[model samples]
Target: MLQMGIIGYGYWGPNLVRNFNVAAGSQVSMVCDMNKQSLSKAKKAYPQVRFTSDVNELINDPEVNAVAIATPVFTHHELAKKALLAGKSVFVEKPFTHTVEEAEELIELAEKKKLKIMVDHTFLYTGAVRKIKQLIDDNVLGSIYYFDSVRVNLGLFQHDVNVVWDLAPHDIAIMDYLINDKPQAVVATGSGHFDRGLEDIAYLTFYYPNNIIAHINVNWLSPVKVRTTLIGGQKKMLVWNDLEPDEIIKVYDKGVKVTTTEGKYNLLVNYRSGDMWAPRIQATEALRLIAEEFVHYVEEGGKVVNDGAAGLKVVKMLVASSKSLKNKGEMIYL
Candidate 1:
């Protein structure tokens, strides 16, 4: 069994710890948090697990074979590098690292050490997303047209990263995994309506190498939480809403039909609306599935759905988008 040390028990730490501790072929042996209350909560949750305030203690522990970093965005790179350099496999929360260069360096280090590096892009592990990928592969959606996603909620303000980095990674990662095409350029526009110098609202657009397109809207000032995505295609369309209780995902058999009328100057755009069906999703926790996949990667060193390389790709896209935003939404080529 692989022993894991979990760092940062704040927001996402408990989920990772719970998932790892119960995951097959893995156990969370140690947990670290600077907050005493949080540490107490961690200890209470997993009585068998050890607790520590110093991350180095967990990293230096010989019993731990892997370290899971669930800390702030800025701490992921250094902590992950230390874990890998110490000859331990590493699993980091989404976006992997802050920049593409950091991710690439970590990937290179993990390769040199022959250690597994997995990123926690949890949504891709969900049955809904997996089925979506399969449908795309089977051409059920036909030729891709556009991807539009809206992820917004009130509050949960992050101190380190802006709204785009905090919220858009999930959508970007999902888009990258679902589509086979690569993005050529990104145009982003954001404004800091809340805290000074921090973007509270942002919109990003991706121009794929193919003629496809993707647009993402993320904000922290929305009145209500909305996790919705629409993938449009020539054959059929898909709508994924995470807020739905039973039917979180619905496949809409709809598309825009264009036709030429008699003596018409332009083609008429007809709306084709058909049926909506929601396939049964495996009702499993995304974190648990991610933990299982990490163990699977540790045992079998082949391609994984969210490996270090895939995380790096998403980081590249994010960095490109951030650059575009910094340049007043100028088109930034990757």
Candidate 2:
């Protein structure tokens, strides 16, 4: 079994530990957290696993073959780099690194050391996203026209990053995975409510080459939580409601067609509307699949969908969006 060490026990850290502990071909051997209360809770729950306050101890342990980092965004590059250099595979939480440079450096280092790296983009492993990818790949949603997403919630405000950096990553990663098109430029507009200088509400728009466009709206000031995405295509349209208990994805056979006149002076338009269908999706836990995939990569040399390169793509968008936000939505080119 491949031994795993986890850093951080707050928020998302527990889920990582639980999944990795039972994931095939892997075991959680050590957990590190600076918070005493968090460490105490972990110790009580998992007495078999070792807990330490110092991160270096976990990284240097020979028993640990891989390290999973669930820490803050700022600490990801350093911790992951150290783990890779110390001959351990690395699994880091999403938004990968703070910038593209850090992601490129770590990717290069991991390649040189022949160590595997998987970024925790759990949504990519979800049944809803998987089904959506299948539909797009099967040509059901032919020639995607646009991608529109809205992810907003109240009060889990982050201190380090704005709402765009905090919530837009999920939809951005999903867009990157489903749509095989690269974004050429980004335009963002947002405002901060508090004196912390971090935006609580933001709107981002990405321009692609083939007349494809994507828009994302993220907010921390919304009274109600909303996680929804709409993908419009030439053949069909898709609506993904992440909060729905059942039928999270609904495919609508709807689109508008345009035809040129014989004289080329006038255009004819046609709108097609058909029945909507929701495909049955498997009820598998996404984190477990991610954990299993990580283990498979570490042990069997399998392919990882959410690798460093994928994470870097998402990061590139995030960085460009931030730059646009700073410039008051001046359209920063990627």
Candidate 3:
């Protein structure tokens, strides 16, 4: 069995521990957190595992073949470096690190050490997203036009990161995976209500080649949680709503077409609207699928769908968006 060590037991810790504990061919050998109460809870819940306050203990443990880090954005680089230097594989949560430089260095280190690294972009493993990919591959969505997403929720505000950094990673990762074009520039705007430094509400726009653009809206001040996105194509459209109980993904056969008259040389547009269809999505947990893939990669060495480069792509976009926000929504090239 592959032994695993988990660090940071605050918000997303329990989920990580539970998934790793049940994942086949893997065992949670140790968990590390600065909080004694968190460690106490882990001990009570998972008496089979060990707990420690010193992160170095978990990194140096010979039995722990891998480390899954769910720490803050700033501490990711140092902790991941320590684990990788100890000759253990590393799995880090989203927004891999604060800067692209840190992410690039981690990628290089993992490459030199021949150690596996998986970024927990859990949504990519979801059944709905998988179906979207399948439809895109089959040209069911047809030629893509634009991508738009709005992910807003109230009061889970992070002290260290802004709303964009906290929430945009999800949308950015999904866009990175689903879109055929890479973003060339970023323009963003945000406002800070409680804290003067951190932004609580933000809007980001991406510019890609061939006029294929994308937009993201993230806010922590919203009274209600809203997770929805729409992808428009020439032939069909995809409406994905996370709040829907069943049939979260709806495919719409509606769009506009333009034809030029020969004699008049004028552009005539035709708008078409048809029935909305919802495709079947197997009810599978995204985290479970990601856990299975992590095990498979460790055993078989297959390239993961959410690999290092993919993480880098999302991080790069975040960095650019932050810069744009600082400059008052100025378009920043990537």
Error of 3 at 101 (Å): 0.9
**lDDT ranking, high to low:** 2, 3, 1
lDDT of 1 at 193: 74
lDDT of 1 by residue, 239-267 (tens): 88888888988889998887887757867
Whole-model Cα lDDT of every candidate shown, in order = 0.90, 0.94, 0.90
TM-score of each: 0.96, 0.98, 0.98
lDDT by residue (174-213, candidate 2, tens digit) is: 9999889889999999999899989999999999989999
Please give the ranking of all candidate structures by TM-score, highest first, separated by commas.
Answer: 2, 3, 1
What is the RMSD, in Å, between candidate 2 and the native fold over all Cα? 1.0
Model 1 ranges with Cα > 4 A deviation: 259-270
